[model samples]
Target chain A: MTSSFLWTLRSFKHFVNGSSICQAGPVEKRGRGRRPAAQVRGEILDAAGKLLLDEGMGAFTIERVAAEAGASKTTIYKWWASKGALALDGYFHAVESTLAFPDTGDIERDLLTQIRAFARLLTRTRAGRVIAELIGQAQTDEDLAAALLEHYSGPRRQLAVAAMERARERGELAAGVDFEVVVDQLWGACYHRLLLPNLPITEKFATSLVRNVLRGIRA
Target chain B: MTSSFLWTLRSFKHFVNGSSICQAGPVEKRGRGRRPAAQVRGEILDAAGKLLLDEGMGAFTIERVAAEAGASKTTIYKWWASKGALALDGYFHAVESTLAFPDTGDIERDLLTQIRAFARLLTRTRAGRVIAELIGQAQTDEDLAAALLEHYSGPRRQLAVAAMERARERGELAAGVDFEVVVDQLWGACYHRLLLPNLPITEKFATSLVRNVLRGIRA
Candidate 1:
């Protein structure tokens, strides 16, 4: 159900461009003289991203976003039901280009490479703070929490799961190893370090982490 | 340095009670009569905790807390330097009684017991949401982040470290076991489950977690 919600949101962009007609059957425009829906959505996301990056969560109000985007409240609401949805949309839009999972033959090597890259993305870039803010605020906001689980966290987790399954099939994992638990420890340590700021999530840290967990679960 | 800061805060209560005279050596009052400093501090913490619990972070402003506590902003600032410090204080004040690290002879059992209790505190109680808010806001507020590490996370981590060191001394752990890494994997997994909310962090999950990590590191 949560995954479907995320899928609907992703497909919304396609639907807006008249490429898909599954849910809500696209938005109807008032006049033919209006700008393209995609352009408007892009502007909104651009404004939202800038607001989040520049000012953090304190300035991420819908009213301010609308003002920044030069769009009306009705126009923004026509696409996103809440501020959380819009913020998540802004997040996915910002990171989709760089968010890739590795699939090298060696699961350990692949995991280490990917985790190191992700650690940098999470700690070195603005995306890290932005993502942490969304995660933090997601605690109190149910809609945001659901949206984050569905859109942001779900896809990445699915990739990790698939990779673990492939490793298991190749007899690379210990007997009775739970891929879910493996992924949790791998990704969880990264997030914990990011949020708690007690440890540095460096490439060395990532390598040692992958080595430790792999040693624990290796066949 | 942060540990010292936490110690200072803890001693603040004693200083306010006219029982200890270290550091600043107590506050000097003006005029003839005044309320007990300890009671005033308690009132402030009570008001802050209530605001954080009842309304969440949106309403947890120093101005509002002062109004709720019927104390001046100056009075609140005299003890706490910022909102983050105050919020963490409130969290510690509220949960100090319930949060205890287990030290059973078996490291695995002790870890599972303590982690399960912590997972519950993070998910089943108001403390979960309160903590999430602090972590969320801590992303942008550096002061709050430091206080959280020093006051809330530091002591618990020390307890876990001590327990692991004891285990290693007993030869219950593998040679060259890194207790820091072990604690990270243990607590990080729980925090990951808490923040992502993708999986339920139950007792069974904790059991499996402790067993798996112990399998890797046990002698």
Candidate 2:
């Protein structure tokens, strides 16, 4: 009976020890030194984006971002020259990761795919909210506006223009059709619908838009 | 010589008095007691919108708005239950003044007219910035979101729908076309372009959009 009781106590101690180990594992690992550079950069951007989304542009201070990212403020300032630069980098990264241009070889299909993807991204993410804040801040901050235009608008537009050019090259475009104008129309309609909130963006609307734009430009 | 000096001094006195009058006129009038309700209401909304555009939603406090409007805090709170209520009123006023729908007899022409008007207003005014801000803020603030839909999106959509219906009644619309869907496409493109900078909301693009939409929807 004494031997059995001792054995039971030993088993209970082992169980308790095992449970404690499991519970303490994550906590003990919490302070593991600096993450890899790429990971640290990504984490910093994510925190900055969350700050921008939650508290507006004014809350996107370098110190706040660094604290949220679990990195030193000196580390962030070393990588980015200013808060605006950091914010711009974060904005650009968020947009690139989420909104990709479609190049399905058929202009109509490609455009439809692109528009729908963009509409979904804009409607469903904190990125959309961040964009609106950036736009508002842009009115007063010329440098930030220029950065947005360069990093966000410029690359996306070049992709769109290239896609339209490909359509023209493939003999899919009508004679005298302005490719730039067509691209603008497609992009404009998509942006307006997403931003205005006057109506929900439905798949049917996307189909009609693609059909209409293709009709306007098809050879 | 005495007469000339006296006249010069009198002129200087008059200039000083006029400057004081110009500076003090609004303050003196405000101090005289209650302003007309309609006038005060308009002033309050204008003040709120200015603050919203300049400083985003964060700066839109009762104290700030009341001070800017030159009205008592009690008067402002009497009309608006909260800052959000005041913001809603301000948003509607700003949007309505700048983005009224066209009613030209030709549906294509009218739609083009409205799109161009919206493009120009959004590009040029603080109204556009404010609208974008409100939309972003609405994503987080459910009350503001509902209020915006009820007051702004609902009315504007009704106007667009009415315009489409008028076209249908006039037999200008194709029998199988969905009017609501077409309007959404047209306006969506326009809104999308406005948010993206440096992309020309050009006359050429506008014409192509109308022509394309008409192609898809015309009887």
Candidate 3:
């Protein structure tokens, strides 16, 4: 296997927007008579993802992944340092396939689309349960929190922040709108509803939310 | 012990803001030998709080509370239907003593005070950990979620909404502000930081948060 194969293990976004790097593209292979490392890595992530979907976070264990993937514990550890790392990789793989960043050029509409999609994902999918489990786990587990922040949340927030910056340049947003605060309020509202489940996170709610916040930010 | 002793068991917030019925002179006794039910109730709550503080949610059991309070199982069951109910009472007892509603008459300042106090309670107290435990538990436990919504989150949210309504009536808020959305954003930001611990929910942050949202809502 080429270094790119190892790179696949290290980097996510293997597939996006109707195209998959894992297929329909050239893969650099350097070895003969041995399966490519990329294939092994893909198998591991698939097993991890299945385990998460099947039994939720409670049953997500590195040892269990080893058994499910028919690989040794050392082999699993060599690829991913801990269960948190492995589970995150699996989570990203799941989330990326299902959700897309909105870029409709209309900032308010884009935000509505993005947040509504997010709310739906958290409330409607099996992945929501897994995300909730990890969030609860992250409260006390510093290591898991760090991994999730670095891999999952950080990239997602960057995308949203970039969208806001683009809107500012387009004169869609006011001169002194703090994107961080706006982003926090938007995302935080959805998260609060998810955690509490006392309020409904309907599409209408998302639309009203974006409109209300944008009223202040719009020039 | 008179029926007034039993009344103490049924009522919460018996007193607030410096005047407490519990400590406002002695009561006339109607029974000769029975212990005060209020004292018994206090012992149970204290024991439950201690268990939550010393060991955490895992060790918080009704059986354990019975042992800790030196009360019989039947007696404990007579008051609370489940561990969640008992723990919630303990949590409320802790929270009520420490936090107070903000009524500074300045809408922005009132919000800042309320949210800052909330952030401090969640970050600086042992009850914070217990609350986190209950939030996580609520994700899976339907019954617990209902009880928390009714007893804890519902009332807390009502107070916040009332504050926003007061602001609107004072013409400090815009014509069409949704108090629920605003309340969600303010409280949610703090909760998001609490769960993730990636961001600081400092006093400055709380002040900034209230100011930012209020900018959107101000007339």
Instruction: Pick the TM-score winner.
Output: 3
Native-contact fraction for each model?
0.41, 0.34, 0.30
lDDT of 1 by residue, A10-38 (tens): 44433334422123323324334455667
Worst 10 residues of 1 chain B by lDDT: B19-28
Per-residue alpha-carbon lDDT of candidate 2 for residues B38-71, written as tens digits (9 for 90 to 100) = 6777888888876765665656678998898888
lDDT of predicted model 1: 0.67
Which should have the higher DockQ, number 2 or number 3?
3
Q: Give the per-residue lDDT of model 3 (tens digit) for A12-85.
A: 33322212324322222323434455676676788887776566666778888877766667766665655655
Best by lDDT: 1
Clashes of each: 0, 8, 0
Of the two candidates 1 and 2, the one with more favorable DockQ, higher being better, is 1
User: Each candidate's chain A: what TM-score?
Assistant: 0.63, 0.65, 0.65
TM-score of chain B of 2: 0.65
Question: Residues B1-219, candidate 3, lDDT per residue (tens digit)?
Answer: 212212222332222211322322222233344446667667778888777656656667888987777666776666665565566566677676555777777787788778888888777666666667556656655655665676677778888889878877777777666677776788887777777655666777777677667665212
Q: After superposition, how far is residue A60 of candidate 1 from its true place, in Å?
A: 13
For candidate 3, give the lDDT of residue A138: 58
Across B101-203, the per-residue lDDT of candidate 1 in tens digits comes to 6677777777877878777777666677666666766665676677677766777778888888887777776666556666667788888887888888787
- DockQ scores for all the models shown? 0.23, 0.20, 0.21
